[model samples]
Target chain A: MNSVLTIDSAIVDAIVAHARRDHPDEACGVVAGAIGSDLPTRHIAMDNAARSMTFYEFDSMEHLRVWREMDDSDEEPVVIYHSHTATEAYPSRTDVSFAGEPGAHYLLVSTREPDSEEIRSFRIVDGVVTEEKVNIVDATVDA
Target chain B: MAIEVRVPTILRSYTGGSKIVEGAGDTLSGLLDDLDAKHSGLKGRLITPEGGLHRFVNIYVNDEDVRFLGALDAKLNDGDSITILPAVAGGALGFAAAAAFFGR
Candidate 1:
């Protein structure tokens, strides 16, 4: 599978905003896209049920509902994103171990620094985390 | 009649390379017990001898982490999805470091 993630600029901004807003606490969410297209279009910022600074867990019912909706719409989570309040934009050991989607890109945004935010994407499969290319494009250029 | 448990690639060895398997139980722990019967060595990877979920292992019931619910006792229903994965962290590497690892 291609390891690169192509996302909308607006979505990136929204994710960053959410991360900043949740500062000190980790923010988690998902971006859904047309099945097999790999083009992320829908952004769904999820509730970190854990509400812990060091960990994040999506609300169970909400996750089920969102996943089912995506299934009905013939879409899938293209990107699974979360923020690191004081750490770097990287999947922690727990993150790597919890990554269940071999097809989804795991995006991490570090809000540790007030002036500069670090964002990165990766593909975590079989316990290995591999960084991927992130290309941001305008959302209005679609045919 | 059975809940679908999605297996991660790393743990597929115990499942005979199957990505999805059926386990019968009303709670997360029960299901794992059922899975243990069929796929030996799998439960050990997920549950510690202390009966708690392995710290590095995260089990999600319908996309929610079981740890937040009831851990091993989380309730389950038929058709509910369970996903098991191993946690690992990455992303702090600079472009050069990532390139060295991913060779991109």
Candidate 2:
């Protein structure tokens, strides 16, 4: 049995496109969807906060809500995605120390360099982190 | 085998777009020094001019982050992989937690 990562091109693209769309500053949001086993990864959209774009801080309740929805749907929180407008695509100390959520993959999109798409993914657990490749596929969302 | 330091996209320009680099050092700081030798500005980005890893940047030895260990001095095995991650996500949940607590 292989644990292959399934991601929608539309989903990851929407996130990366959001970052590129709002270039020169960080763009971020939570990916709400069921993870694994033929789930559409659907009804998934980027949640925008009015606070700021240069940086994003997920709302705990929102975070909890997403997790609960995934659980209720028999899904797992697959990935946590973010963009770096001015910095590299690695996990910052804040990212590692404050992950709070385990087993979920962290995806970083780089928008600092324009005219090209720069994105990377990682699996972080118990402070031991490993890199994973992003597989983008076109996904159909259930409205 | 050498410890492979995975470079993030934001810091790649320092290494001329080189993503992975090898170091023969046994400590995280030593690896940084080796990287700095090849890419000078990298050290400035990861650490302050004062030689401290910026609050936003983190170095991980294999799966164990150096911060929880000895930080820069954290020991590494021959096959360890060091990952550099930067924190720049939006809507950090910290403020949200405070708002929820005070019902603000």
Candidate 3:
């Protein structure tokens, strides 16, 4: 499996925007892609069930519907992402423990600063998280 | 009734290396009991001695975290998907090297 995460610049913008919009509260979402493609195309911003600045949880019913739709479309969760409001972009112990996707990239965006946003990606397998490089490209390049 | 349970890689050893297992129970706790009966030592890893879920373990039914739903007593329905994962805590320190979890 590739260790680097390649995504479109537009998606990155959207994620950052969401994180910024939800300042003080963490934002969570997923990027669905075709099976075996490793390309994240669909950006699904999820509600932070916890709605806390320190934590995030997806609404159960929403998660079920979205997952079922992905299954029906033969798509998989290519990227599972969330934001850190005041802290840096890093997976917490809770995040690592909750990671169920060994093949999907776990992306973290930090909106700690007013003008700067930091984004990073990782692969969590068997509770072991490894940082990976994120390559942002123009959407047309991937299309 | 049969329920589909998704097991994480670290805990798959107790499930005979199977990522998915069959379980039957009306509630989340009952389902866990059923799983433990089939795969010994599995319950201890998920629940603590106090009868509550482990701090590092997370259980989700049908993609929703049981903690928000009803925790150990979360009701289970036939064909529900239950997923178990270990909580990795790290975002406390700054962003650098944040992905590398400190304590197991």
Candidate 4:
């Protein structure tokens, strides 16, 4: 049981914003950052993986964008993130089955509670998903 | 130092689909309790009655693994974050290893 972890404000904000924007269904995206201490979590895009049912799709184009951003910044892809509109904040069989040996952290956002933010983060090696406690540090991002 | 907790897609079912959650504590175990209180179903699913993590789950205080750092008792702080990940197995990509290391 590890103690605490850190995630980027932009990523967190992006996830929250998307979930709020598309309620009643799940929204998904990718995060790219250098791995080491605190791998920054940033959202690159959103999708209707299962517009009919409740599913998500991580856009490959956005992934390229984030990958390029990391490249320009001299950072490597470190994490991938997604949201569950009406599901638990934990990983599912689908997620595990599709999870490529990404060699980075896999972050998930929860939106079932609605009353309070059930946002949580975790790491998945192979198919096993491990939950990580996130400690948020507000950064200055000029809009 | 504050530990940043990373949220995954599955557990988002409990968070209303929020991607991040923050907490404070002095150990991985304590931090989980705090997190479970703040969010929901975090502790029950992650921790087992054996007083250790669910085995399928892995927690890290910073980059150091909780099992290596202090296990459930790993220390934490106001800014520290915890990541909850589960084992995803049953695939051709070393499914056994994934299940052995993670879960099926």
Per-prediction TM-score = 0.70, 0.49, 0.74, 0.49
Each candidate: RMSD to true structure?
Answer: 7.2, 14.0, 5.2, 16.0
lDDT by residue for model 1 over A55-77, one digit each (tens)? 67676567667766887899988
lDDT of 3 by residue, A1-143 (tens): 89899999988888888988888888888899998999999999988776777777676567767766887898988888888888878777767766767778999999889999899999988778899999998863332
In lDDT terms, which candidate is top? 3
What DockQ number belongs to candidate 2?
0.07
What C-alpha lDDT, on a 0 to 100 scale, does residue B64 get in candidate 3? 79
What interface RMSD do all candidates show, one decimal each?
A: 7.3, 10.9, 5.6, 11.3
Q: What is model 3's C-alpha RMSD?
A: 5.2
Query: What is the DockQ score of candidate 3, to 2 decimals?
Result: 0.23
lDDT of 2 at A15: 76
Instruction: Please count the clashing residue pairs in each candidate, in the order shown.
Output: 14, 19, 13, 80
List, for all models, the DockQ compared with the true complex.
Answer: 0.15, 0.07, 0.23, 0.03
- Best candidate, TM-score: 3
Q: What is the lDDT of residue B14 in candidate 2?
A: 83
Q: Model 2, A78-138: lDDT tens per residue?
A: 5677776767787765455545345456777777677766777776665666777666666
The iRMS of model 2 comes to: 10.9
Ranking by lDDT: 3, 1, 2, 4
How does candidate 2 fare on TM-score? Answer: 0.49
Compare candidates 2 and 3 on TM-score and give the better one.
3
